[model samples]
Target: MKTELVQCFVWGVPVYRQRFSLVASRPATERFYRLIRSAMAHAEQLRDPFTGDLECDETTFGGARKGKRGWGAAGKVIVFGIVKRNGVVKAQPIPAHDRASIMQVIQARSREGSLYYTDDWQAYATLKLRGDHVVIRKEKGRPVGRDHINGIEGFWSYAKNWLYPYRGVPRKHFHLYLGEICYRFNHRDRDIEPMLISLLKRLTVDDVDLN
Candidate 1:
C-alpha cells in the first residue's frame, strides 16, 4: 500500500484514485474492504487519561432537515461518544437515546471507577449512583470540574463541517461512513499515506468500495 501510494504521489494522482487502482482485483478488494470495516468496528475504547477520572457524554449526529426539526433527526443517525480528560476518545452509533441504549454503551466502554461527566440529561443522572456521575447545565454556563465534553463535541463538529462533504448519507450505510471517521480520528496525528496504510494493513480488499 505504501509503495502504491508513493507511486501515486510521484505520478500526481489523487490518493482516492490510487486507492481505486490498488483494489482493481474484485475478489481481493472485497476482502480488503471487509478488513477496513472490521478495524473501524472496534475503534473506540476509553482512553487511559479519561479512565482514571473521566467525563463521558452522548450526542446525536446529522444536520437539521429542511422541512422540520425532529423530522430531520428521524432521518439522521444517533451516536454516543465519550472523551476522557487524558484525551482518549471513542464513539459509536446507537439505535436510540433511551436508557437501555445509553446504559449498554456506558457499561461496555467505561470502567467501574471512572468519573462520568455529562449534562443534565435524565439518562446521565444515574451516573451518580452507579459511579461518579457529574451533571452540568449546558445553558447555565460552562460545566465545572473535569466535566468538559469538548472532546466528543469537537468530533461531532468535525464530522458535520469537515467530513460531511458527500452530504445526506443513507442511514443503512452509516456504519461504513462511521468506520472511516473512526479510522481518521484514531489516527489524527498520522499523515494521509501512513493513515491509509494503517487502515489497509488491517483491512482486506473487501473493505473499500469506490463504486
Candidate 2:
C-alpha cells in the first residue's frame, strides 16, 4: 500500500496530514488529532487574557446519533468559547453548559478587571459583579459602543463552517477539534511556524508516538 505523510501550513496554520491505502494502514486520524491537542494543552501560554470586550457564547456540535435537542446533545458535545475584540478566541468542550460549568471556565480564564459580554443567559449574570458585564437581549441589539459580542459570534460562524465541511465529527474527541479551531482563531493573522513550535514545546515524549 502506498502511504505518505504531508505537512503544510494552511494560511499560517500548521497542518500535519497522513495518506496511505485505507486497506492497509486504515485511518488513525483520531489518534493524530488527540496527540496534537494533548501537545497543545501542555504548551505554556504567556497570558490567558481575561479582559477586554470578552464575548462569550455556547454552541453544540457532534454526530447524528439519537437524542433530544440539547438533551440529546448530551454525550455529544457542548463547546463554550470566548473571544476578545482583537479576534483572539479560546474554546473548550464542557461536560455541560450549566451555570456552574460556565462559571468555572470564566473564573479560570478571565481576569478580575476585564469586561465580559454575552447574551441574556442567566448563567452569566454573576459576571456583572466580577467585571463589567454587558448582556444583550434577542429583541435588543448588541451594545453600540466598543462593547459588542460580535467577535465571539464570528468565531461561532467560522467553527460551524469548518465542521460542516468535515461532516459529523465523533463526540468522543470533540475537545481536540475545538482546540484546533481556537488556535486558528487566536492566531489567524500571524505566521503558524511560531505557533507550531510553541505547541511542540508543550509536548512530552509520551504525548505522541513518533514510531
Candidate 3:
C-alpha cells in the first residue's frame, strides 16, 4: 500500500503536497482523493448505534451566517449532529430542523435509554420520553464538566474547519464531505493510517451515492 498517498490526503490537500504531486499527476491526485471521499463517504458506514451521554446539536453549512440563528437561517443548509462524549459523532443534512426531522436522526444513530444533553430547544423536548434529557440554559451560563453539549458543539467547529480548506462544496456533494468528517472524527483516537487504508480498500463504487 502507498502510505504516503493516504498520508497526503489525511494531512491536507494533495495539490500543495509537493512530494506526492511531483510523483503523481495533479489530475490523478485530485481524482484519487475524490474517489476516497466517495468510497468512505456514507453515514450508513456507522453500523452501531451510540449510547451513553450523547450530545445533540445543529449547525448550518454554506451561505452567509445571517438572519435567524439556526434552523431558519437564510440560504444555509441545516445539519443535525449527535456526539457521544468521548466517542463517535454522526451528522446528516436534514430538510427541516423540526422535531420530527431531528428525532429521526437521533433515533437511528443512537440507542434508546442514553442520556442526552442539549441547549434550550423545543425540538429536543421529544427526547424526554426516549430518555433522560438535560436542558442547559445559556442565560444561566455554562457550568463546568458534562453539564453542557460541548462534545457535539466541538464537532461542529472541527467539521467547519475541515470543510473551510475546500473553499466551497456544492450542495450535491456536501453529504459525502460531511460523511468524511464523521468518519475522521469517529476514528480520531486510533492509528488512522491502517484503518483508513483498510476502509479505502473495502469500499467500492457502490458505497458512494452520486444521485
Candidate 4:
C-alpha cells in the first residue's frame, strides 16, 4: 500500500480512495495524501530564497465559469510564482494580482537585487526599483530577445497538467496541492523515491511504536 502510494505521488497520479481501496482503507488513502502534502510543505519551507536571474508570473486556477479568462478572471484563484534560472521554483495563492499582493510575495521569497524577468504587467513595474527588471514584450507568440518567462511559465504548465487529473481541487486545500507540485519541480533532477522514503519515515506515524 505504501509503495503504491509513493508510486502514485512520484508519477503525478491521483491517489483516489477507490484506486487504493483493495490494499488500504479510504481513511488510510486520505491519510496518505495528507502525509504527501505535509512532506511537500516541509520541503517547500526548507527551500532557499530565490536569488539571481529569476522569472515571475501569475496564473489563475479554477474551472471555466461565466466570465473572463486569464489575468483578473473572476472566481479563479490567483497564484504568483517565481523561478530562479536553473534552480528552485516556488508558488503560492494570492488574493489578487495587484501591486501590493505581488510585491509582498517578491519581498518574502526573493533576495534583494535579483534580476526579475516578467511580462509587461503593470503590477511588476515597481520591481525595477528594487532590482534589474527585464520586461519581455510579447511579439507574435513569443517574447522579444533572450527575455522570456519560460521557466516560471513551464512550472505553471507542469502544475496544471499534474492537477488536471484531480478534476478540481477545493479552494481551501489548493495550497497543499500547489506545494506538492512545487516539491516535484524543485526535486525534478533528484531520485524522488529515496527522498520520499526519507520524508515518509520522518513524518509518518508508522515509524513510532506503541508500548
State the lDDT of candidate 3 residue by residue for 67-130, as single tens digits: 7766576778899988888878888899997889899989888888999998788888889888
> How much lDDT does each candidate structure score?
0.60, 0.64, 0.78, 0.82
Candidate 4, 120-193: lDDT as tens digits: 98889999888999998987979888779899998999999888989897677788888888988888888788
Candidate closer to the true structure by lDDT (higher is better), 1 or 4:
4
Residue-wise C-alpha lDDT for candidate 1, range 1-211, written one tens digit per residue: 5455433432334234345466345445444444444555444322332365565556666767666555235566777777666565667788887778877878777777777777777877667766777676665566666447676677777666544554455566566656656556666775655555565566544544433
| Cα-based lDDT at residue 82, candidate 4 | 95
Q: Which residue pairs in candidate 4 have backbone atoms (N, alpha carbon, C) closer than 3 angstroms, thus clashing?
A: none
Q: What is the C-alpha RMSD, rounded to one decimal, of candidate 4? A: 4.0
TM-score of candidate 2 against the unseen true structure: 0.75
Clashing pairs in 2: 68-72
Q: Candidate 2 lDDT, tens digit per residue, 32-51?
A: 44565555543423346567
Off by more than 4 A, model 1? 1-38, 42-50, 66-68, 140-147, 202-211
Over all chains combined, what TM-score does candidate 3 have? 0.84
In model 4, which runs have C-alpha deviations exceeding 4 angstroms? Answer: 17-21, 72-74, 204-211
